[model samples]
Structure formats: structure tokens, C-alpha cells
Target chain A: MLDAVRTARPRVQVITNPVAQGYTANMLLAIGARPSMTSSPEEIAAFIAVSGSLLVNLGILDRHRRDASLTAVEVAREMGVPWVLDPVKVDISPPRLDFARTLIGMEPDFVRANHDEFVGLGGADTGEEAVRHFAARNLTTVALSGPVDIVTDGTRIVRIANGHPLMDRVTAMGCAGTAVAAAFRAVEPDPLIAAAAALTVMGIAGEVAAAASSGPGSFAGAILDALYGLDAATILEKARLT
Target chain B: MLDAVRTARPRVQVITNPVAQGYTANMLLAIGARPSMTSSPEEIAAFIAVSGSLLVNLGILDRHRRDASLTAVEVAREMGVPWVLDPVKVDISPPRLDFARTLIGMEPDFVRANHDEFVGLGGADTGEEAVRHFAARNLTTVALSGPVDIVTDGTRIVRIANGHPLMDRVTAMGCAGTAVAAAFRAVEPDPLIAAAAALTVMGIAGEVAAAASSGPGSFAGAILDALYGLDAATILEKARLT
Candidate 1:
């Protein structure tokens, strides 16, 4: 996946919460991809027209922000650019859940959710059932993050069990993971392969962070260090992507 | 300054644009400052209550975001946490200029502005005069950015004549500079010294970026590399603080 990103250097457009814009864009750049964030509806279509992939995150959702996200998704679809959706904290409210459902109809190439969010969206009794539900919806890829990450492409499912438990303590680890997924998706055409690669990398980094840090504060710093320091050879050796 | 930040590891609360949030926070972390972004009026005060310093940015101002910025400044003032203000595009309109004036009245520890913005806010004929105007208004420190940056504490002024011309082409160099200033302010209690250190560092990095790149797109990448690669010794050696 890193090889593909290095070779393609795909341009990724992210319309996410303003909080993560700078870090997410720099993260994409660090991994050898171009990134731009445009939220104005006037600019979204033009940006989507040029981007290789799009990532929509509903982290700082407001009426104005939601309008922009919807417009960006519509434009990405029209341009045939594969898009990923991060339905951050959708289970928090009925309005948010309904909004997520509306986005689901946009047919994102990948949908990423944490354990609770996966269960909320899929009504699944277990992670495996959640994956199955996502597959049944004809979603290209479903990434369910927890103790073990499940990446499925309807017919085939891969489980990555590399990340540490400490990752659950950080504030935006899931959002960062979504950004990583978008980075991989920017380069790889297959959403399943991209999702698998991202989950593996994040999980491995999480483990490395846990080894270095004692708590959430230091863990956030360590996670970034591990992600920035990770190499393809190291990933192949340490990743549990099956 | 790096020694101070490395030792203190201050938590700096920032109320700024969503576009630059991630980059600003990452840069702060790279330099050993903990950064959090909260734009909600309630959340801003809540975070600032525990933070070491406050950084308020009026970069992408709108009706809703302006309230958060105002609330943050008020909280910072009440808490006596040294704060820096970036009056982005204050020169563009009367309303923005008035808004900046109102905040300036709150007596920020430091004021960081680009040449045009400084002139616009102060109604000065030149950047130097703008710095003087800000200093006269009881501003503890004022940094006016141009080809050469002038950082002052009323009586003593340092001229940093480093940096690349290509930096002028980028969109958020000033905002990034403000973020770096906030990082420095988080470490050093003396607003003048902190502003000088940040301005000098950003200037030198800009020069390095110009040497390594052909245009704005490539220069942005090189600038990040320069910022990440720079060390305290190299900064002090090449930095023209006076």
C-alpha cells in the first residue's frame, strides 16, 4: 500500500471537522499523498473534480457544515471519485444517525465505524454480524474497529488484531484512523485492500505506542511517532492483516 | 525557548480556523507543546481553565465562529493566561478591522500580523509604523511580518531579515506563524522574547524551504521538512533575532 501511494501520489480531498484539518493534511503529505480541505459548497465541486479520492467526516457537524459535506459527497459521486465516510459519534443522536443513513445512500466506497458505532449502524449482535450487515448493503468496504479490527468486502473478510487497548483512551484516534484509511484509499483502487492496509498500519502503530507510553497523553504522541516511523518492511513483519 | 517548552510541555488552548487546526497542533507537538482546539464558547472557557496559554485566531471568521473567538479572549484575559492574537485579513473590511480593534482592547500579550494586515489594523503607512502603533497601544509584543519581520516590545525591536519570497504565495503562512508564536508563548512568559523566537524560526525555515522548492506547492512540503528538521542550535546560529 505504501508502495502504491509512493508511486501514485494521489491527491486526496478531505471535508472534515476544522479541528483535524491541519493534522490530517500533513499526515497525508507525510505518507506521500497530496491533500486539500475545502468546505465551501462553491469550492467543493471544483476540489472534488481534481481529487483522486474524497473523505467526509461528520465530526463538527452544524447546519452549514452538513450542507458542505453533502455537496462534496454529491460532487465526488458525479466525478466518479471514490469516497470514504467517517460517521463520527452518529449514535449520539437520532438526527446524526439519520444523517449518516442519508450519507450511506451516497454509496461511499468505504464506511469506517468503531465497535459501538458499528453496532448502532448495523444493528449487529457482534462485530462479525456488523461486517455481514455492511456487506449485505453492497458497501464496497466496511471497517469495524475494536480490540480486533474487521475489514470486509462483502465476500471476503480480514481481521487485524495488532493494535493495543490503550488506543481506546485517545480522543481522535478513530478520526486519525479514518484519515489513514483515506490516505491508503487515495492510492489503491480497491476499497477493501485500502481499508485492510490502513487498519493494519494503525493497529500496529497502536501497539508500538502502547509499548512506549503509560497513558493517553503520551500515547497520542507515541502513536504519531510510530505512524511516521513505520516502513513497509516493518508493517509486513508486524501487521496482522488476515 | 525550546528548552522551556521541552521542560514545561504546556497545554495551549487554541481558538482558530478549522482549516489550520491539525497542522497547528502537530507543529506544536513537534516542538513539545500540547495543543487543543475548542471553538465552542463554553468549551473554549472550559479548556482555557486548564491550559497554560491561549491562542486566538481570527483567520476564517464568520458569524458563528466569531463568538467563540471573543469568548476565548475574554476567558484568557480573566484567567490571566498569556495569549496571542492573529488578526487575519483584518484589513479586508471595516467589520473585521473593528472586530480586531475590539480584541486588541482586551490587551493580548502578543499580536502577530502580516505586513498588509498590520497596516490595515493600525492604519499605518508602513509595517514598521504598524508595529509602533501596536506597541503604543500597550501590546506587550508585536510582530509585523514581511520580507523582513520586526518583533518589538515597545523599547526593543528585533528585525528578522531571513525567509523566502515564495512564502508570500502561500495562503496560511501567517496563521501558521501565529501557531508557532503560540507554542513559544506557551513556553516563555515574556511575550516579546517568545514572539521573537517564533518569528525567527519561521523566517529561517521559510528561507530553507525557498532554497529547496520551485513554487508554493513544493515549498509547502519543504517548509514542513524545515520546521521538523530544525534544531535549537541551528535556529540560534542562523536566526537574526536582532
Candidate 2:
């Protein structure tokens, strides 16, 4: 995935939580993508105008933050630029889940959610059921990240039996995956292809991280090491997309 | 530096510009530092309460952003955790210089500045003169970064001359240096040692970047590669710090 972005530099605008802003933006840069992260609603139109893709993550959302995300999505829609929505922890709270559903109505080009989040957003009993619910929503692509990721684009579905269990131990790994998806979207026009590419890269990196670390504490660094070390040829060879 | 941070994980709070937020935070994580980047004044006190070190960067300061930096400094002061300030483009505008001066009065444990920024903050006519002027400041340590970096804690001074010219071609290289400094600070309590380690590491990586890239477009990736690839033995052998 890094190789793809390095080969084809893309301008990506990320409107995310303040917590992971620094790391996410830098990771995008390390992979050869131009990153812009701003939560100010006043700048959303201008940012979307210059960017090729948008990543919206509601990790730490508030009343004010929701407005910013809506503004960004509106501008992205007007510009005809693709955007990825990450409904982080939407299931844990009522207001958050309601907001996530409202955001879904905005017609995001792609939606990246973990098992719990997908269940919450889809109002499904299981991960597989959640994928089916999302598919029915007419999303361009929906990724259900877990031990095995399920990616679907309404009619077509690809299940990636890659990645490591250690990824579940780390906080914000799913958010990072969403950021990687946005990076892939910047380079590839097809949301389905981009989702597969990001999940493959992340899964390969997760496997590398699991081999190098003992616990969640050490896994984060190892994950970054894996991302930095992994190349396109290796990605193509190791990726398990079906 | 990465080895040290991996061994001793530290929680770092960064109050910085939105542009490099993702990359800087990720760089800290790559080296095993927990990074929290929050610009909300409402959350500054709570965030700094758990942080081991504070990093403030004046890269893209606007009227609304100044409040957050000031709040962070206030919280860091109350906590007594070591804080480093990066006075970026201080000379380019009056408001920026004034904000930097106000933050400096709050007493940062370390100050990381580029040649241009050092001269501007230290009230000196040249880079060398800025080093001399900053040596007299009340801060615990001052790092003046350029092709060669000079780190001083009043009595003891170290000069690191290892980076390449290509480093100047890239944007936010100084912010990366500042993030590295925060990483080092998270592990080592000594401000001088942390500043020296960060300057040496960033400089050596810059040299490595120069060897691999033709311009700024490629230098960014090469710089991260150099950082991820550098080891303590190699850094000590090649580092010009004295």
C-alpha cells in the first residue's frame, strides 16, 4: 500500500479525532501521500477543494465536532471527491450511534468499521449480519475488520483471512486501518480495490507485528516497523483476498 | 533512541499544528512513546495530567489556535513534567514571535529551533550568534538545529554536525525533529541528553535521506526509512555530537 501511494502520490484530507491526528498524518506522509487534518468547519470547503479524498473518523465526537464532520462531508459531496467514514465506538453510545446513522445518509464513498462498530451501525446481531446490512445501505464499500476482514461493495464481497490476533489488543488499530484505507483511496479510484489493498497491507503488517512483540504495548511499534518495511511485491504475494 | 523508548514507554502530550499532527504522533509511537494531540483548551488540563512530557509547536498558529497552546503550557507548568517548545517561523510574523516569547516565559525544559527560528527567538543576527545568545537563556537546554545542531544546557554544550542539505528542501523536518525530541524526553529525564539524542538522530537520518532522494518529494520517505533503520551503535559511530 505504501509502495502504491509512493508510486502515485495523492492529496488526502483527514478530519479525525485530535488523539491520533499526529500519527495518522505522518503515516500518510511516510507512505508518500500529502495529508491535511483540520476540524474547523470554516476550512472544510477549502480543504475538500484541494484534496483528492477525505477521511472522517468520529472517535472523539462532540456537538461542535459533529458540525465540522457534516460540513466536510457536504463539501466532499459537492466536489465529487470520495470520502471514508469511520464510525468508531458508535455502538457504545446512543447519541454517537444516531450521529453515525445520520452520517451514513450523507453517502460516504466508503465505510470502514470494526466488528463492534459494524454491528452498532448496521443494528445486526453478528459481524456477517452487519456486512449484509451495510451492503443493503448502498455504500460504495464497507469493510468489517476483525481477525478475518469482510469487505463488500453491495453485490461483490471479499473476505480477507489475513492479519494477527495481536491487532485486537492495541487501542486505535482499527482507526489506523481506516486511515490506511483513506491513503489507499487517494491512489486508487475504486473503493472496493482500495479497501482490499488497505486491509491486505494492514493484515500483513499485523502479522509482522505479532511476530516481533510480546504484548499490546510493544505491538504498536512493531506494527509501524512492519508498515515501513513491507513493500508492494511482498504485499501482492502475501495478501489473502478472496 | 528507538531502543530506549521501546524499553521505557512514556506518555507524551503534543500541542502542535494540524498539518504534521498525524506524522509526529506516529513517529512518537514508532519509537514507543504514547502520543496525545489535543488542541481543545477544555481538554488540555485533563490530557496533561496523564502525560510524562509536553511538546508545543508553533507551526500553523491562528487566532483560535493560540488559546490551546497557552492552555497546554499552563497545564504543563502545573504538572511539572518536562516540556519542549518548537518556535516555528517565529520571525515571519509578529503574532507568532509574541506567542513564542510568552510560552518561553513559562519555562520550557528544552527549546528546539532551526537556524532561522533560533536566530529569531534568540534575538541574534546569525545562526552561530543565536547559539551563543540562547546559551545564556534561563532554560535547561536549547537545541539550535541546522546542517549542524548545537545543544546546550548553560555549562555543557554539544555540537552535532551530521545532516545533509536536502533536509532543507522538505517541509516540517523541524517538526519531525521536535517530535523526536519529545520521544527522547519521554524516556530520559535529562533535558540536555534528550535534546542531544533527538538532534543527533534527526541529523543522521537527514544525511541518510540525502543519499537516497533527489528532492523533497522523495526525501520525506527516505528520512523515515533512515530513522526506522538507524541503530544505537551506528548512530554513536557516525554521530558528530561532542
Candidate 3:
């Protein structure tokens, strides 16, 4: 996935939260993806037309952003562009949670979220049960991320154990994670492999970053550097799959 | 100003562009200012009511964010809270430029912008001319940030020569700079001194961060770390004011 992303240099359109916009764009740029965060309803369709993948993040939802996300997803589906959904902070807001569930009906290629958000999407505890529930309904890859990230389909489950606790301290790490899934999905055909590869890249980078960081402040920069410096050999050697 | 911010722990409300949110919030947090980016019109007034300072940035001028910024600034005025206006990217959008010009009549306590934005706000060339133009019209301090940031009122001019060129490569540095001014203004009543102090903090931190960085990626982390570790002695000894 890392080699594919570096070679293709996918152009990704991201409809994300205000809190995640800067860092997410920076993260994509560091990882060799061209990112555009155009949220205007009038302009979103046009931008998604040229994008290699789409990332829809339902965090800090508003009328305009919601409209743009809906439009972009529809266009991405029509164009056969892979998209990833991140239901960020959905548990805290009922309307946002409902909105995310509605988008789930669209059957995005990948749905990545934390344990709380995955549960909030009307799924049960334990990543296996939740991902199995979704995979049974539709051909989608479900990733329930936490201390040890979980990636699965109905038949196969992959658990990644390469992240650090310090990742939880930084803001927007989850948002950036879903974006990595979108970038990987753009080049990798299998949704399950794409989701797991994205997690592997993020987790390995987190471990490397945590080693060099004093706190979350330095961790943010270190993570980007690690991603930029990542290679296929390192990813193949460091990946912890179960 | 740094001492005041650390002691008071001011709660700053920011109505800024999507691209500036994460880093701006991080900058305020590292500087001991509690930051909030509530943009809903329904909640902007309530948030501003409790905020120590308000920062309205016209970076990505959307209707909702603009309305929230306008509402927050008005409420800030009524509540006697100092506010800073950052007319970012005014050169690109005429409607947003006009909107920023209209808000200028509201008599913001401080106006911070780059050379192009200052010129877009109907000010003349060079930081001195543009800032003096605004200062002459109203009792507002104008900050024109560049290689050597210039902060001034109608009667007095303070030049800050402590920054590095690498700061220009990082996105949202100017927005974060304006946010730092807002944080300082929350504690220091005098706008000129407050703006100068804020610029001093950012500039000196930039110099320190640049020395420790290999490129923009590490520089981003180093800047935050430097800001976190900054002291009065460092600022006094490293500040290059003319």
C-alpha cells in the first residue's frame, strides 16, 4: 500500500472537520497524496470528479459541510472512486450519529472509527462482532481502532499491534488515519487489505514517532516525518498482523 | 505578556478558517491559553460571553463561519473582551475582502495581517504605511507580519526581527501568530505592547525551532516544543527588536 501510494500519488478529496483540516492535509502531503478540502456544494462535485479517492469525515457537522459530503460521496460512487468514512465524535451528537448511519447505507469502501464510534454506529462491542455485522450487510471493510487496532471483513480479521498510547494524546490522529485508508483504497483494490495496510502504516509511524517525541507536540511532527521516510521494506518487516 | 497568559490561562474563542484550526488551537494551548472554535451561530454568542479574547480570521470565508465570526466579535465588544482581526487571504475573494473591510468599521482592538492582506484592506505599501493608516483612523494596533514583523499604533512603531524564513513554509503560521496576539491581549490591556510581545514569542520560538529542525516536517514539531519550553529570559535575550 505504501509503495502504491508513493508511485500513484493519488489525488484525494477530503470533506473533514475544521479541527482536522490542516493536519489531515499535511498528513496526506507527507504521505505522497494530493489532498483537496473543498466544502462548497457548488464546487465539491467538480473537485471529486478529478479526485482519486474521497474521505468523508462526519466531525463538527454543519449544514454546508453535510451538503458537500453528501454530494461528494454520490459523485465518488458514480465515478467508481473508493471512499472512506470516519464517523468522528458521532457518539456525542445524536444527529451526527444518525447522519453517519444514513451515509453508511451508501456502502463506502471503508469505514474507520474508534471503538466508541463503531459502537455508536449501532454495532456491538468487540471489533469482530461489529465488523461482522457490517460485512454481512454489505461488502465493506470495518476498522475499529484503539490501543490495538482491529481491521476486518465478515470472514477475515486482522489486528494490528504497533501503535503507542501517545497517539491518543494528539488531536486529529483518527481523522488522519481514515484519510490514510482513503489513500490506500485508491490504489489497493481489496477493501480489507486497503484498510489493514492503512492501519499498518499509521501504527508503525506512531511507534517510530513516539520514540522520538517528548510529548504530543513533538509527536505530531515526528509522525509526519516517519510517514515521509517510510519504505515498503520497513512496512513489510514492522507489520504485526494477527 | 507571556507571564500574564501563563498566570491567567485565558480562554480564547477563535472563529477561523478550517486550515488554521488544529495548529492555531495547538499554539494557544502551548502558550497557556484555553482555546475554543465554536462556529455555530446558535452557540457563538454564548461561547463569546465566557471567552477572555476573540480571534476572527477571514481565511476561508464561508457563510456560516462568517456569520459566527461577526456575531462573536459583536458580543466580544459588548462584553468588553479584546478581539483581534486577521484578514487572511483577502486578496483572493472580493466578497470576503469587502466583508473584512466592513468589519473593520467595528473598531477591532487589533488588526493582524501579512503585507498583501494589509494592502487589500486599503492600506499602503510597507508595514509602516499600512499599519499607520489603520492606526490613524481608530485606536487599533496593526500588525503586519513578514520576515521582520512590524507592530504599531498611530504614535509608536515596534519592529520584531527575531523570526526565521522557515516559518513562511509552514501553513497557518500567520494565523497562529494572530491567535497569539489575541491570547496576549486577553491579559495585557495595551494593544501595542501586547502585539509586540506576542510577535516576540513566536519569532524567538521560530529561531529556536529552525535550528533544531531538518526540514518543515520536524520544524512544525520543534516550533511547538520551543513554545512549550520558552521562558522570559529566552524571550528577553533572543528578541531582536529595533
lDDT accuracy of residue B11 in candidate 1: 80
List the TM values for chain B, per candidate: 0.90, 0.91, 0.97
Residue pairs with backbone overlap in model 1: A18-B18, A22-B22, A22-B23, A23-B22, A23-B23
lDDT of 2 by residue, B1-242 (tens): 57887677777888777776755755565556767675565556666777778899998887656887787788788778778899889978888998888988888888887667766775465445456556666555788876567887777778888888877776667786788898788778788888898888878877776787778766766676567667888787888866
Whichever of 1 and 3 has more lDDT, that candidate is 3
Candidate 1 lDDT: 0.76
Candidate 3 lDDT over B193-242, as tens digits, reads: 98998898999999999999999877877888788779889988998998
DockQ, candidate 3, comes to 0.17
What are the runs in model 2 whose C-alpha is more than 4 Å off?
Answer: A1-55, A59-65, A70-84, A87-159, A163-242, B124-136
TM-score of chain A of 3: 0.96
Greater lDDT among 2 and 3 belongs to 3
Docking model 1 quality class: incorrect
Candidate 3 C-alpha error for residue A23, in Å? 5.9
Task: Candidate 2: give the clashing pairs.
Answer: A21-B21, A21-B22, A22-B21, A22-B22, A22-B23, A23-B22, A23-B26, A25-B22, A26-B22, A26-B23
For candidate 1, lDDT tens digit of each residue in B1-242? 76677578788887777666755665566556667775654345656877888888887788777887888878888988888889888888788888988888888888887777877876465556656766876656788787678888777788888777887787667777787888788767788788888888888888877887788876765676576567788787887755
Write the residue-wise lDDT of candidate 2 on A111-166 in tens digits. Answer: 88876777777645445655766676655578887767888887777889889865
Task: State TM-scores per candidate.
Answer: 0.63, 0.66, 0.67
Flag the better candidate by TM-score, 2 or 3: 3
| Candidate that scores best on DockQ | 3
